[model samples]
Target chain A: MGSGLLVETYVFVLAVFVGFQLISKVPSVLHTPLMSATNAIHGIVLVAALTLAASVRTPGGIWVAAGAVFLATLNVVGGFVVTDRILGMFRSTKRSE
Target chain B: MNTVIQLLYLLTAVFFMLGVMRLRSPATARSGNQLAALGMAIALAATLWANHRFAGGALIALAALLGLVVGSAAALKVRMTAMPQMVALFNGMGGGAAALVAAGDWVARGPGGAAGAIAALFTVLVGSVSFSGSLIAFLKLQEWIQGRPIVYPGQKAVSLLLLLVDLAAGVALAAGNLGQGPTPMGLYSLLALLLGIQVVLPIGGADMPVVISLLNAMTGLAAAASGFLLQNQVLIIAGALVGASGTILTQQMSRAMNRPLSNILFGAFGQLRTEGGQAVEGTVQSATVEDVATLLAYARRVIIVPGYGLAVARAQQEVRQLMDKLLQRNVDVRFAIHPVAGRMPGHMNVLLAEADVPYDRLYEMEVINPEFAQTDVALVIGANDVTNPAARTQPSSPLYGMPILNVDQAAHIVVLKRSMNPGFAGVDNPLYLNPKTQMLFGDAKASLTQLLKALDEV
Candidate 1:
């Protein structure tokens, strides 16, 4: 138990490094799409909300979980769909079409 | 089972990383987004399986379905012009979810230890701030609220006081949890929300892109804090990725404007309407749509620069039509895109792309700036600050250090605007008064449509 927080801290620090390295090279042209796409990825928090939703033993818990799940899912679904729509515009195609 | 779930989470994190990395190019960005979505779906499925208590599955499914319909509708139906506000809304929702989830956890399980309490406190505080800040950003972008900075006497001091209270409450809450005593969770939550609104309310519309980017990073950090409370690795990974990417994007945008992050956040810019609406220091000239059309017809080369005005008028399609007509006359037409153009990064590109303009024809500032001198005609469409010669000539101007399009260097310049209203920064554009410049005053779309019609008769 004493070592748990330290382990999590190590994971957090390492992930921060990985994140900076991974996103450092994205071009300016793709920044909007990249932001939207990353916005979708952060919707991963929806899973936590859903996990909380699935164990609703009390009415209060049920409402809280449901609201969290809904917002999280909105972030996930909206973020991804919007990214896809924006990226569709960026796809190279014949000009006349 | 636990090992399998952890490995699945690990795999999801890898996919998330790959998604962002692939976005480095235009070619691979779509597939990268798809890959990341797949990771999210997988993480979601794993969470359901791992956390399901069997009784609440149906309700959970129902909530997911509701979210699916609402979110997809917003993403699918929103026009490209309004995409920045939509992004703000979505980012805010993510932050809202992180805050809500942390609160839910607190209600269900209370605090576990010093670490849990601290993580929970950070999550709620940061998440609430991101959520509220993003909401204000959305409203500003939507024009539901004033796009200009709304400031009051001692606003910064009040904000500072709120920050102090929030920090004190956070300490009390964390200490209480450590001592297994009563927590001041509600006080911290209220202060967090207030702090977010205060922090974002004074930033003007011109700085929205930077503000949105910063909020995006805050949401990511908040999500990571939620992951800490729940001991979840995938949330930490995805959140950290967004945090990093958003931070980098914010810095890039700030650099493009030649401003520091601190100034962008705290600078109550766009509030000074004092000198912007004043009489011009020099002679001003206005041109009709027909006059601009004739100029365009004979021009050997034309560069079109677009700003938020073009987006507001929904004129990209018409602008494209004008470009086509100019092309028919053997005019070499290209678009000059400033890095910080429009309300978001790559905003003008997306708007032009919607009009089916070839991506190749869009030239970034550095790539096309040198060609301005050679351009026979420079058409400024609803663009202001980016083309202001004040950036280059007037050192004391608010926009002095920012990079601007060299439209003033063109042989001929025509500006389409509704009025002489200053741009988001509320700084007067000397480019409007340049000797070679001509203003075609009207809504950008209407002017472009009229220009297209006049060209047809030419």
Candidate 2:
């Protein structure tokens, strides 16, 4: 692998580790907020995956990059959908007398 | 190529941190969401830029457009009321995607890479289970399926057997034995499916908040497993965050319900009607809207405590209306929202917000619980279990230690309910017998409407 590619890979992996570590320290009460934030990170990962896939020449590299893109996209979109749905359970309505 | 990608990664991390920081308050949550979305868009664009494969840019652009259209439509179309189901569906999708990835990886590897094979196996099992389990939970919440527990003889043993089979399949897959591999994998998935079904089937409507928390945790575990399979640190980290948060929330919820986690998991507490259950021995006092209206109109202070019953009846708007009327009369009105008032966390808050109730008027269980003592009247609408005095007074009761609204401390308590049926925890509320408490038996919405009408007259 080229030095540039190697450096990018390290940064990506390091970012993931650091992000998780920092988020792990978040208090339990702040989960919804933390989740909302991490969800954005997942989006970034998705974009990065696509970019890596595009630039990589090797077949294996292309496949892995594509896979990363899919997984990361799923994480971001899925998180929001789930969070919104969970929030909906609390909507109160008037009862029939 | 790498410099650009690295810059994108750095930007993504910054946005992620910003979003996480913004989540500390509800006021900034929307902004946080937008920031995260922006970060994700940047990341996607960067990835597309990096790709050198066949028309990678076109495919990325196409995917982005498709995603934007579909996502925007869902965001615009889905009402806040249907959010929980949406969350479940999305969680299922995440799990499903992870499982598919594992499957694809396995197929690509030709079943020879032992480590990859094991990781794939774990990911698929966890992901599939979470996917199916979350779907069932969504169904239960949506009332697409019954929320009541479905139990027959030997149900626990059956669940145990299913779990055992799942474990056995994991062992076989890890051992690189494909001879009977597919069978066990299929069986493991089936058992996980049943586990989801059986686990949720017995829980009552009241337990949905906890169920959501539990399911959220499951989804996290699934994601983390998928991360391991893909050797992706970020996935693992994100998944762990979700899993741990969900677990903690579940514990807090369980505590709020005054039940041990074991009882919640294995006791099937809400499923069966206790045998020899007799009608609660109490002198039930009844009231009319006129009487309630009179009391509220003259009262120096009134506290409203809402519960799942309120949500079920969709009485939040009427409740808000009632509050407005009471406020106009110079009655000091405030809401006493229990921590576990609705099916999920912040359920009551969300419901009240929809009614355009001011954020200031709403008080958490801890804040309002103490104020109930000095309050002249505690108006409980369609709330049963959370306000039950049994949680505080009855040691033998299932909800004995659970924190309640303390509505019983008020000089006068008004409870509106459809019937005297026991709550989800299957315990009778002794608060109904309190001389100061009066039962207004009817649909909560209708009762509130009548009360509002009577208030107008008063």
Output the number of the TM-score-best candidate.
1
In the range B372-419, model 1's lDDT, one tens digit per residue, is 999989999988999988888777788888998999989999999999
Residues B21-61, model 2: lDDT tens digits: 56555555556656766665665566555544643544544
DockQ of predicted candidate 1:
0.71
CAPRI-style docking class of model 2 based on DockQ: incorrect
Residue runs of model 2 more than 4 Å from their true location after superposition: A1-97, B2-7, B50-72, B110-118, B179-191, B276-280
Summing lDDT over every window of 10 consecutive residues in candidate 1 chain B, give the lowest-scoring window. B177-186
Per-candidate RMSD, Å: 2.2, 5.9
Off by over 4 Å in 1: A93-97, B54-58, B177-183, B275-280
TM-score of each model, in listed order? 0.95, 0.82
- Supply candidate 2's per-residue lDDT for B38: 68
